[model samples]
Target: MQQTFFDLEVALASLPRILEGLWLNIQVLVAASIGVLLFALVLATLRALRGPA
Candidate 1:
């Protein structure tokens, strides 16, 4: 009897699910990046305004 660390069968069976989850993560990342960029733009604009502060 022998034990192995890598199992191709198990990995192949789960690949589809893993890819689906990865796609979902990518969508979330893009949305978050856009949100951060918008927030930073607003903050920078406020800082650039001429006022006493």
Candidate 2:
């Protein structure tokens, strides 16, 4: 069988690189989320403390 639009061999060859990119994206997403949460927490703490300390 032959296909023009999709090729299994080519796709299979590219799988590892694709997986690496996906993992990199996931790491970036998690780091960004943590940074955002920390920033928000800092702001909220400041707002709550207001001039108390």
For all candidates, the clash counts are 0, 0
What candidate 1 gets wrong by more than 4 Å, as runs, is: 1-5
The residue-by-residue lDDT of candidate 1 on 1-53, one tens digit each, is 75545878877988999999999999999999999999999999999999975
Clashes of 2: 0
Q: For candidate 2, list the clashing residue pairs, or say none.
A: none
Shift of residue 22 alpha carbon in model 1, Å: 0.9
Per-residue CA lDDT of model 2 for 1-53, tens digit only, reads 76735778888988999999999999999999999999999999988885845
Residue 29 CA displacement from its true place in model 1, Å: 1.0
Query: What ranges in model 2 sit over 4 Å off?
Result: 1-4
User: Which candidate has the highest lDDT of all?
Assistant: 1
RMSD of each: 2.4, 3.4
Error of 1 at 7 (Å): 2.0
